[model samples]
Target: MLSDRRLFLLTLGSASLASLAACASGPQRVERPMNGDFPGIPFADWTDQEPEYLLYPGDEIEVATPTASELTRTVRIGPDGRIALPLIGSVMAADRTLPQLQQVVSAAYAPQLVRPTVEVTLRQAGPIRVWVDGEVRTPGVFEMIGDLDAYQAVIQAGGFAPTSRQDSVALIRRGPGGSRMMRVVDLRPRRGEVVPLRRGDIIFVPRSTLGELAAFFTQVRAALPIGFSYSINGSNGSGFAQF
Candidate 1:
């Protein structure tokens, strides 16, 4: 983490008046309401499966030979909703249907691998990384995978108490021109009534604007001291650990 004072200094140095105004005025793009009480997207039109047309990066997945019980499984998926297979490398797997991906994988491995058995499954689907960055009991990043709506996303971020303003949660997405804002979700517990998450989605549960200021101060109080650290990579087979 960058030091708070340094971060603030950097922000001040880099940002122009117009940029600050833009960031302060509001996030770009439209704002939709989270609750379905307003009534939209007539259930009939909503499909149970994601679109097989496009795949973005950051798709967490697991592939293995189910034919044998000795699970020879391997996995790979970045935070952007993509899958990496043996010969095919990384293919957009977020939106593609299973059958469609299966065919693609089979064809890719046909020449080099003999009877190359492969299966593509989304261990965690969706590219929406819900960043709970403000006042909450527990705050961090939650990978918005399959069936993870606002409520579930918040729960994974460790839920909220009475202090939480359910209606204040906002979803941030990057668009063609700039960062777009989509619907402020009112965190509520509901089973299977959430929208299907797409790749590159960023849901931020911000408190009220003043609440935002308080959050900033809270962060300031925590960073009285500064520090840094690093770790070495690479495991040499047998018992990879430091004593």
Candidate 2:
């Protein structure tokens, strides 16, 4: 039978070996909505699956018909979210997918022709509008062209100011339930650290807490006393008579 001390040493050695094996396996990648610290906040990845691209105002689309070339044309969604195609006249295009709009256009032209085939392709995406506020060189609403990350978005907004915090950034997103949630992004610029920005997303860069503490300490140091001196005066006896 094994003694108690021997059993204890054996267990400790096994634990150490397991820990070393875990380290050799390399660090695990962190997925968003991180554990205890960042609860309820979800960070979106740059290579996430393509979301349902809804048609919005100012979006340009190309419509084509295999059977009828005359019916094909490129059109833009108006401010009222409607597009004027060749034969379909004015059709609602907002809040619709490309496939959905193609079906609508095909059905509209079906009455006028023996056979109508329609295809809709998004030629140009609408302004991917996002707001960059707090600690940036230029803080305002910006219309980004292509895929943008928080770091790239801040650069587009004129980069970070001197006081801007580069450690972490805040991203505000409106959830499907209409409630707003904020995620904290690490701005170390490591591989796989680029977080994709969505339309209506808000990026806020704050001042560093360590910077504030340093400033406070500087002020305190300036106000502190450099040096001090003290002197005591004593008089003996009376004038000079008693000793």
Local distance difference test, each candidate: 0.45, 0.60
TM-score computed on alpha carbons, candidate 1: 0.37
| Model 1 residue 82 distance off true place after TM-score fit, in angstroms | 13
Q: How does each model score on TM-score?
A: 0.37, 0.48
Tell me the tens digit of each residue's lDDT in model 2 across 109-191. 99987888899999997766777866789887677787888889888878888876554565665444233444556665454
lDDT of 1 by residue, 1-243 (tens): 443233332222222222334457876432343223123211112223433433334445556544432533445444334556554676555445566666776666667566756676766543344455444667755655566665666677677655554554545433332223234445655522364445444445444334454445554455436432110111542211111
RMSD of 2: 25.9
Which stretches of candidate 2 lie above 4 Å from their native place?
1-47, 56-58, 110-116, 125-129, 134-137, 143-148, 159-168, 172-182, 188-193, 196-201, 206-243
State which candidate has the highest TM-score: 2
